[model samples]
Every structure is written in C-alpha cells, then in structure tokens.
Target: MNTRGQFLSSRLVNDSLISLFVVSTFPPFRISFQLRMWDWFQQYCPWVLQGISMVYGMIVRIRRKAYQREWLRPKHLSRPVVSVGNITVGGTGKTPFVIWLAHQLHAKGQRVAILSRGYGRQDPSKNLMVSDGKGHVKEWRVSGDEPTMIAQHCPWALVAVGPDRFRLGQWVLEQTPCDCFILDDGYQHLSLYRDLDLLLFDATDVKGLCGVLPAGRLREPLDSAKGAAAFIFTRSETLSSIQPVQTCIEKVIGQSINPIVLKMVPKQVRHLVTGEVQPLTFFSQRSLLVVSGIGNPRSFCDILTGCGLEVGEEIRFPDHCAYGQDEANLILEKIGQSDQDIVVTTEKDAVKLREWFSKDDPVWFVTTDLEFLAGEEHILGLLDRAGVV
Candidate 1:
C-alpha cells in the first residue's frame, strides 16, 4: 500500500478499535459478538496484538523523544509542579489520591491549585473554574466529577479544569496565583515539566510480565516509570502483597527504592441528601443494590463485601457515565423490585446521580480515604523536598 493508503487504513483500524472499546465498556452490550471477537483476538491471535503494540510503543517513544530532544519545549513555571499519574489507562484511585495530597499540602500551609483535563465533562476542552479558592463548583457537568469531588472535599484549595494545562496554568495565575500546583493524571502530559513525578500503580502480581494495550493495562511499558522520582503502589491489602511488585519495580529501575504503599480505606457511607452518616457496616444486614459508573467496579464491590454489606445486585455503567433519566428510572425500578433495601455507589457516580435523584433518594455513596500502609513519612518527605511546605 502507498503511504497515504497505509495511513488511512491504520486510521480506520484505530477508529474501529476505539468503537469496539466503547461498546465493550458498557455491561449490557459488552457481551456482544464484538467483544467476543476481541476476546478471541487476545486468546488466539497474539501476534496481531504484538504487532500493534510494537507500533504503539514506537509512537510513544518518538513522542517522548521529541520532548526529550527539545524538539518540543515543555512549559515550566516558577511554582513547584507535583504530578500524580499512572501508566495504565483506567483509574488507579488517582482522584482520591490527588484529594489526599491536596489535604496534606493544605495542612502544611501551602496554597495548592489542582489542574486536570476534566475528563468526561460536558465542555472540558475549555478552561473553567472547578473551585474558586473555596470549595464551590459552578456545574458538576462543566468541571467533571473528579475535579468537582476535589472541590467539594477541599474547600481551601483551588481546582481548575482545561485540556490544555499550559493555557489553564496561565489563566489560573491571572485569576489567583498559587504556591504549588498538583497536576492530576499528568504522566503522559509531556507538554508540562513537573518537579516531582509520583507514578501510581495498582497492586498486581509480579510474576506476570507487564503487558500493553489489548494484552494488558499498561499504557506505557514498565521501563517508562524508571524516570519517576518515586513509585506509589495503591490498593495493597497486605504488606506482603507489595513486596513482589516492589521487587519488580526495583528490577526494572535497576535500584532498590522504597515505594509508598497506600490503602484505600472506607471513610463513611453518607446519605445522598439527608446529611446522615453511617458506618460502612451499617448496611451489614440490609441487602444492598450496588451501582457504579467507575473505572474499577470490582474494587468497590470488594470494599462493600469487606465491610460486611449483603450486596445483592450490581449495575455497572461505563466510567464517568452521565446518568440520564432512563438510567435513573432503571435504578429506581431496581431499588423497588430487588431484595435490597437501599442503593450504594461511588462518590463519582453520586455527583451525576444528584442531577437525576432528589434529596430524599435512598442512594448513598461510600467515601474512601487513602492512608499509608507503612511509610507516611515518605509522602511528607517528598513534599518537604519539593518545597510544598
């Protein structure tokens, strides 16, 4: 094929795969033949994935090399920029982690500003105010759920959303200058230079080779994290579970480094509107219908089960689903007919549901907190070195 022919053909394939991925994300239609074909490719046609991954890896390397070679100059500001990101595409509890980091920084008397691409917002391409110094979000849909959640949680910190961080940073500086900036989900955002890069990873088995794309969750190869100043492992149930992953990381980076282990601890289960709080075990006896539009629904289910909730049914939508009236009606119908007494969901989903459900709704969201499994001082030390304090 000619150059243009190959380019068009490749573009067509990329478009097709993206469409398939979209279809596969939703549970209702995910089990269709399209997904089945994808599964078949993964199981039997390994070389095809390998071929695609090689091309993908080349693209990743070339783009990174462009930035490294100064063919593309990364924007750098006077203020310290701390980035929290992951190699994988899906959420590794990054939003909650960002909020936690903000809380810690604010406790130390630093003016913090959070900048996100505002993924899944109605108009995320343009810069907008998620929080105006005080925790006040203009519109949940306008700013995206994660930024909105941060704004709701951290009243003192400022959160802004724009796809272009360079433009967003300038706009933020003009509006209100901050002492420090936290770039959320910014590992691949090479347009900006970060003083500190904290790469986050979900706990996985070390024995398995870190795979990419259709084969695995790795957005970039394991070698990519070698440049990170520190590695943070999230969702470790036990101290022992972290060792193997740590060993793997050390092996990849060619040195022994102490990585921070974080636990996503359930904080509380609060009513969607009534302002009533309950212990996680409050729903121990009450059969619950769990609903979530999150990246990791299984983890949410596991947390609920761990809390001793008698979870009966689960309805999962794609990550950052803007719950419409039809979805609301379905939830209501499920709540009415199911043996469950009430509905439970994640905070991200709760933000969307508030638009559909009223204050009297039986829906409750489980608020989670990220706590250090061992090295709380490491996070403090990183901040201390970054001049966050």
Candidate 2:
C-alpha cells in the first residue's frame, strides 16, 4: 500500500480506539451512547422491538394462565407471605417499603423473615442468609445491595437470599422461627403463593407503562397488575404527578382503583465510617458531589435538592454497581479538596461503596422512608383482609 493510505488507515484505527476508551471509561458517555443507539433503533426499526415485546407478552400471559389453571401449582409456606414488587423493571423503592413493612410487623411482635432473589449477588444460585434477625451474616457482595440495605435497616428481621424464594423461606423456617415472610420483588414469581401482593409503581414514570419489555420498561402487560391486592405509587409528592399514571392503570383494569400513594421522605444522613447520623437539615445549602448507582438516580438527586443541598457535580453509575478503589478515586477527584464540598449517595450504594471509602473521606448516605400521602388505611385494611396482621 502507498504511504499516504497506510497513514490514513493508522489514523482511523487510533481514532476508533480513542472513542472506544472514552465510552468504556466514562459512565456518562457510555449511557448516552446506549440511549442514542436505542433511540435510533426505535425511530428506524420500531417493528423489531414491538415484535419482541409481543412475544414476551404472550409468554407472560401463558405462564399466568398456567398458575390460574393449576397446571403449575404455587407452593405455600406454613407462614403467611406478603410480596412487595412492581410491574416495571426497577426503581419502585421496594427495599424501603420492605423495611417499613418489617418495622410494622415488628411493632406487632411478629417475627418477620425477608426472602429475596438476591439480584446482582456474586453467587445468586446458592442460597445464603443475609441477616439472622439480629445482624448481617453475609456481606453485601454475597447477599446483594438491596437485601443488605434491608437487613441493615431491619436488624430484627431475618433475611434470606437466593433465587428460589420458596426454598429459602422453607430453609429459614427450619433454622429459625418466623411469624411471616416478606417476599422481596416477587410479583412475577408465580412458583410461590403469596397471601398479599403489594404492587408498586413510580408515580413520576408516566411513560413506563406504554408497553412491555424491549419496547418499554414494563416487565409484563398492564393487566398483570390487576391481580395485585392493592397498588402503591412511590415518589408521589403531588396529585398532578400521580394522576396520569393512576389514570392509565385504572383504564387498563377497567375500574376506578383508588391507588395508595407513597412519598419517599428523606429520614437521615449518616456518615459511612463513623456511623453517626446527622439530621437532613445539616447538609442544607452545602455543596455536594452527588454519586449514585441506583435504579432511580433522578429521584435521589431530587431528594437531595429538596433538602436544600446544592448539587455542584453529579456522577451516575449503573444500578447495583459494585464500587472499587478506582471509582472512589474518580469521585475524590471531583470533590477536589473543597471543604464545602462533600460526597453523598443512597443507602443502597453506601453498602458497596463503604469498602472503597473510609472515615477520613467526606462520604455520607441518605436513608429514606415511605410516607403514605393517600390511602394509608387501605394498607392496614388489606393486611387485615389477608389475615397477615
């Protein structure tokens, strides 16, 4: 080949390599690129995603019918099981709601056991105990971030982790006494029969209910939610925000279902290393280098902003991200030795980030609780109806 042609080829290869490095090394770039590609596909080849979603919807309906027809009988444990789940993929605040439910059960002197699929765990196939109703028995890496966070919040609740929640619940019953079981994210787990199914939806996500799977965020068609004992909308601060999603849900159910609305209120901010909790007001007006690796990062940021903290810089990572020293270094670089600037994250991320950050670092995490804005009595009424209380 000619010298000019060789030079041009080398330049093209180098440019491609540089572009790949930027996309892989930076989270923002990678996420933006992925979104752009998905948008292009949706705009040009809409049939492909729609066709896949149609097939997925059919499979969902068939599986649901199997359970209904007793072709696939659901196994029930001796104890009552209450499931907290969502129709959409993620970010429904299941962990916080689970924690809240556990606390309520604990108040009634009922021994509670939390059964989880332990998504994002290193060895999800193996059944593991996260907390034995006293404290954590395994690390976050083994138990998964959401389960670990639940265990941390509800130390008095026994937490079991595995793919098969029925088997996990059985094993827990054998090892220890439990008055009831809280199935974490078990909406689609038809293998186990639940006494009460609490289906959750993010009120802010109006567009999420558009379709199923590849075409949209929904895991199953809207009709699947009809089986839920009661529907709960999370992050519902205003009526206007909740109306659109609620209307869509009622339209599909062919009835006026007055859904329960829950506002995720920030409870406290605790130092990761010292374990000292500061009031949410302590961070008011302070500059924050916000770091989050959760399903609804925008919700987290909005909560921080609502607390009157200034988000000077923000870094978003994929949901259930396993933090490392390199990521910590990158965060520290963003902070850049500013006394007024501090790093803030969600409690879920804190579980994994603690390994890379220490007491000396200006790192803290926010803890949130579910506050019922509407239909608080509905939850209690459902619990009573299910005979779980």
For all predicted structures, in order, the TM-scores are 0.88, 0.88
What lDDT is reached at residue 117 by model 1?
A: 91
**Backbone atom clashes (below 3 Å) for every candidate:** 0, 0
For residue 180, give model 2's deviation from the true position in Å: 0.9
Please give, for residues 199-219, the per-residue lDDT of candidate 1 as tens digits: 888774342236666565567
User: Model 2 over residues 227-291: C-alpha lDDT tens digits?
Assistant: 89888989988756789999999999888887888998998999988888899888776877777
The candidate scoring highest on lDDT is 2
Candidate lDDT (C-alpha), each:
0.77, 0.81
Tell me the spans in candidate 1 whose CA falls farther than 4 Å from its real position. Answer: 1-34, 69-71, 204-209
Question: How far is 82's C-alpha from truth in model 1 (Å)?
Answer: 0.4
